[model samples]
Each structure stands twice: as C-alpha cells, then as structure tokens.
Target: MSDFWLDLGFRANPYAVRALAPTADGRRLLVGRDDELAALTKRVRNSDLHPVLEGQNGVGKTSLVAVAAYVMSQDFKEGRSQQLFLPLGEPLQMKDDGSELIRDVYFAIAQAFIAHHDDLRAAGRRVPRVDDLETWLNAPTYRSSKGGGVSTPLGGGYATTGTGLNTGSAFTDSGFQTMLRRALQEAFPGNSGGFVGTLDNLELLDTSSSARRVLEEIRDPVLQLPGLRWVLCGARGIARSLANTPRLNGVLADPVDLLPVERRYIESLIDARVHVFSVDESGRANTPVNADGFGYIYDVSNENLRDTFGYAQDFALDHDPAFFLDSSPAEIENSLMAWVDNLAEKSARDVRLQGRMWRLLEDLATAGGTAAPGDHDAYGFNDRTHMRKNVVELERFDLAISSRDEVDGRRRSISLTSKGWLVHFAKKRDLLGQGALDLSMTNESPEV
Candidate 1:
C-alpha cells in the first residue's frame, strides 16, 4: 500500500512507538552510556564500595544502570545479579524518622528479592526461594487488620512452640534486621561469589529511618561479602543528603554523578534514527519518486534537531564535547531555554500542533527521547487524537500529505519538516530576542 493513503488512526504511530533500541541492558532504546556503563560494571564486579549513579532527571542514569545489570547477568553465568528497582519518588511520611524508614527499606528490598525469585533460583544461588524471603521480609509490627490500620503481632518476634508453630507471628525490629542480613548474605555469598544490584530512585525514602539503615547495613564492613556489590541510581539531591548521613558516608562518598547524555552520543542516537527511518531492518534505503533526492526524513520542530543532533553526535565522537566547546552551564541553559520558549509558542498557536510538540518536549525532558506511544500519554501528555492531527498538519506542511485525515481511519505518522525546524528556530529566536522581535506579533499565526 502507498504511504500516503494508509488509514493512520487504525495504524500505530512509528514516532510514537519510537525508543532508542535496547543495548546490553535488555532495552532496545538505550543510547549513549558507554563510560557510565563501564564504570558501573567495574564498581559492581570489583568493589565493596557502593557506587551510586547520580544525575538530574532525564540524564539516562537508570537506563545506564539497567544496561550494566543486564550485562553482568549475561557475562557472568555463575555471578547472577538481580535488579531491585526501587522507584521511590514520593517521600514517605516523616522524612527523618530512622527506624520507621529502616522498616520501609527492608520491605522494599525484600520485595525486589521476591519479585525476581525465579531468576535467582535458576542461577544456582543458595538464597532462600522467594516465598520464604517474602515471609521473612513482612514485619510483625504491621498486619492488615479488619480496620484500615495494621495490627501488631501478639508476642511478636517469637514463635509459640508450646503447641503448633504460630504462623501469624511477626518478626521484631531486631528479627527483621537479622532476616535482612541473612537474605543479603545468602544472595551475595560472602567472599564466595559476585552479585550486582542496581537500585534506582533513593530519594523517595527522604526522612524514613528504615531507608538509611538499609544503606548502613548493606555498606557495613561486617556485612561485606566479596561478590556482593551495589550500584544506586538516583537524583543528586538523594546522593547529596545520603553523603551527609554518617551511616551512608562510606556508601555514597564515592559516586558517579551522571550529566546529560553527551551530545555526540545524542547525535549518534539521531543518526541511528535517521538510518532507521530511511532504511528497512535489513539496512536498504527506501526508494521513491525523483523529488527530494532521498526517501522520507522528518525534521520535526526543526529548531533544535540539528543542534540536539550535533550535541549528541559531538559527545559520541569525542566523549567530552564540553572540553572542546568551553561553554558554561549558563550558555547551555540559554540555548536550551530558547528552544523551550519556541516550543511553548508553537504549542500555544496550533492547538493540535502545540499538544504533540509539547508532548515531545516533555518526553525529551523527562525520559531522554520520545517514548513508545502508549508510554507518552502515561507520562502525562496528549492523547492519540492530538498526535494524529499534529502528524497530518506537519506532513501537510511539506506537501507530504495532500489533505487532512478528518476521517476516523487514516494511517499517518509525524516527521518534523525542514520548515518545521525553521519554526522551531523562529520560536527559539523569538524567545532569545527580547526586544528584537515585536511582542505585538504574539496574537498572529506564525506565518513566515
């Protein structure tokens, strides 16, 4: 079927499903994390010192960590590592209470262990199967009661051995702590084997005492197992605070704080996208009519495509584009903010266009690049209808599409146009030019 007349509403959006393909991390869309990946692998395999992947949001810390873990698991068959993903964004109530926080941390870790039990068992590890671990992790202090609140276990911490063993009994703080330590030892196998853990989002347990205690206990020299290593991925704020606590001093003292994915690497990402868009899975470029030279290639919101493309490419090429540019943070921010302002204006003008454009920007800001279509809406952006309209308008801009897909069933996808890129530049230029452009031009459509 011709690309033009395909019913898009029924067809899935390629740009929407787009993700940077997974790397060694089991994800198809992992772009630009070589150094971070190497460093994390080393820390996980060689050191007792807990390594944390620290960075701002959208910096690809989690993706890097996940990739490392996936690599470790594959490379070392004997040394099976399980990822205990803790997405603690919402800080628990009582930010500073240590004991309560510790309890929460224990539960969180225990849950991770439980979730990946089958994987652990298949690897010849001696850790108690997930079921037993779950039982041990659930504390005696909190029981689901008929009322909403948890009920405390009676004669907690000890089993009633005078008769049948009390299955309902809960573990005390000390007991829970002991169970956790055992679990760690079992999985890690002190001095015997290697285990890598990638724990993400430590910022959520803010004041929870339980969380801090987990770090302390895990990092304790006494609990040191030769093969057991931890790599934490979280915000700089979490790492900073973790550094302050004496308990976490050793664990977080040495961390790899990630910056934005190097621009060159980002460019590599774009290049890859260009390749995929222009060619098929086998790598042959798509053939078409004589116009435009090559097959279809989009330049959505052309403002920053080249620049963003350049930044990613330069980073990938040199590994340290910043060293060459000598640009300051303020300069980078100035450039970025200009791009943002342009996006804002674009979004405001074309109701349909604005939604998809802003949604893409948010995805870039939050999750690095455009996520799979379903995931975009999940991240709090426009729905499919908005996306469809934007694609039609953008394609129409380049004469790629002759008419609108007002009908419910139409196969359409969005690719930025050269003109769209100009629009992006115009918006950013407008943003950068305070008194340069007339503010009175605001109400008018962006017809250049």
Candidate 2:
C-alpha cells in the first residue's frame, strides 16, 4: 500500500474519505467553506445557545465544525479572540440512554483537558478538578501512586475507593457532576469560554421524537453545563426538529442548513487536496483523477464530497494506476463516464419497477431533484396514494428518501439519492440513449 501511493507521488491517498481534522493541514485542505467557517465561528463566539446544523449526509458537516473550532482555538490562543474555545478532539456520538450520554460528555471533557493540559496551563487556565478527572482517565494507559479520600455520596454515605491511583472513586455520576462543575467554573470563569464540543448524527436515534426526549432529559445536566459550547448536527430534518422542541427552547440555536459546495469550487477542492497530500519535492503529484474527472464524480454524488472521494479512490484502486497516469485527458474522461454509467446500470437493474416508474424518476430529477410528497400532480402522479406507493418503492431501492414535518403534518420533503443522480446524469448526457447503461429492466435506484 505504501509503495502504491508512493509511486503515485503521494505520501498517502489524497482522496480518502474522512472528516477533515482540527489541525493546520485539515484547515489548509478545507476549501470553499469560508462563509460557513466564519458564520460558525461568529455563532459560537456570540451565542449562548448551541448551534444546530442540518445538512444532507456526507455534506462536510463534521469537517466544517472541526475547522471552525480549530480556527477559534488558534484565534484565542494568539490573542485574536477574547473568548478561549478549545475544540474537543471529535464529535461525541449521541446515545440512547441519558445517563450514558452525560457520562460521555464528561469523559470527552476529561480527555480534552488531558490532551491540552500544557496549553491550558500556559494560558493560566489551570483546572485542578479537571486535572484530577484527567488523571483518572489516564489510568489504563499508566498508573501513579497518587491517592485521595473518598468523595461523599449524594445519598449521604461514603463513596467507593481504590486506595491508590483509583479509577472508580471519582467516576461516579455525582462525582463527575461535582468535579465538572468545579472544572467549568475554574476554567471558564463565568462564560469566558469553554471546550467547543459537538454531538453528531441525531438522526440515527431512529426517530426525531427519541432525539428530542434524549436531549430534553439531559438538557439541565448537559446542555446547561457551564464552560461548554456545543454544535449538534443531524441530517433529514432531524436538527430542525430538535430546534423546534418546545421543551428545549432557547437551548438550541437556529439550524444551520448546509448545502452542497457550490459547483464553481469543486475543482479547487480537488486541486487543494492534491497539493496538500503531495509527497514529491517539486510538488508534482500523480493524481489519478483531475479536476474535471472529480466534477463528474461530484455530480454523480450530488455534490457530496465524501461520496466523490470514495468513488475516486475506489476507481484508482480497482484498475491499474498507469491508466490514469499514462492516459490522455480524453481517455480518462471516457473511462470515468463508462465506469459510472456501468455502476448506474447495475443499480438500475436492482430497482424493481414494472410500470411507468421510469417516467416518475425522470420527472423527479427534472423538478430539481426534490419535491414535497403532496405535490404528486407535479411529479406526474394521478393521486397522492399512487405517488406514495412509488415513493416507498423508490426508497426501498435506495433511490429516494423522504422527511416529514411533524408540527404541520402536511409538509414533507423527498429528494433523489446519489444513485438516482447517476441515472439522471445518464439520461441528461445521452449515456442512456447511447446504450452505455441498460436501464430497460428498472427505472432508477436510490439510497434511503
């Protein structure tokens, strides 16, 4: 693997699909998100409520949060910002249980304190209680002979202890809350600033109601925690749903709807990654996919950076590297078209549509690729019931996904999937007409 990438003139695969880190290299590679970065930093800097972020899956939500947090941290440390915000290492995954989620928050806080201990100390923001939490966190990795008295339990009894370098004594729920409060007061001193953490993928909670309940249950304990700023992210309207919770009013900020990167910036995004991951001293990297090739992949992915990178990386590995390094631009273009067309063709065959579903798919794509489910007439359906059946079928085949608005119960948004975009591309670019993909058996495929 090393030699494979090295021969490609890269220290590593440039298009690997992962969240951009909260670091200098990640910041440099992050392109076309200046407005979002600025807005996020400003929102974090000025607002008391946690920002809610809503976007299509793989639209760079995590990376945006990461880079924004990094910038804020750097600004504060360099005296460019008044409020000091150290981003937690990564977004905390929301859990089903309230207690477990609360514990995760404290654990993440402890981890950040340990990770940035020297920086905090140098800034004169020493948090002794959090330092103790850090010590307990480091137990499995290394042990010290440090000892302390048992903390009194909330029920007015002696808490458990382990005599030396104890991991259990200070790990109880009451102890975590007490120490965290103390840590927050000492480190932030009444909202001066605190750890910038994120809770991601609330949509995975199985339902919006579940997410709301979980958040509400921990609202007082977690959201109200001082010295902690949070950004909560979800897809498919989940973030917006959380924002609308009456019980959580004033706790979550307005949802930041993240759209796909503008088409104009797609090329620079590719080039920036190419340059950032380059290994050659002359800065000439052997890129299998150029800007134009990447644009096509991006289009097929509906502008999803994660999917585009995955496809590009997979294409490079699935075939000989020389095909890209040695071939002409025309050859590369032709090869990519064929590759994507073939994938779409395979996906199309997997979709079971025996009637006029092809026309419905075409209509959906022509209508800007998204529509409200009630607008069945606009989608060429005779009635809502028929359209709904087709919607379920499309969803089952992973070609479209639908989201409901619970408050009104009348508004719902259904959008085409990335695979559906490939079919759209085929039809629009004459690939289907040219027999590049045999879509006779089925209409289209989508990811739910």
Please give, for residues 370-422, the per-residue lDDT of candidate 1 as tens digits.
Answer: 22333325544356555444345545444122112122122111223333444
Model 2 vs. true fold: TM: 0.85
Per-residue accuracy of model 2 over 1-448 as CA lDDT, tens digit each: 4376777888888998999999998898789999989999889888999998888788999999999888988998889977788888788888888778887887787788777777777778855544445556655621222334454211112243333423433344235566556677777886578888889988667467778889998899789888888999887666765686798998999898898889899778878888888896566987888889999888777788888999888888877767767888898888887888877666565555533666677778777566665687776667667777877877787878775544422333567888777766655555453232444445544411
Task: Report the number of the highest-lDDT candidate.
Answer: 2
Compute the lDDT of residue 117 as modeled in candidate 1. Answer: 57
205 Cα displacement, candidate 1 (Å): 8.1
Candidate 2 residue 135 Cα shift, in angstroms, is 5.3
Point out where model 1 deviates above 4 Å. Answer: 1-28, 78-101, 132-174, 192-228, 234-247, 270-342, 346-428, 431-448
Worst 10 residues of 1 by lDDT: 289-298
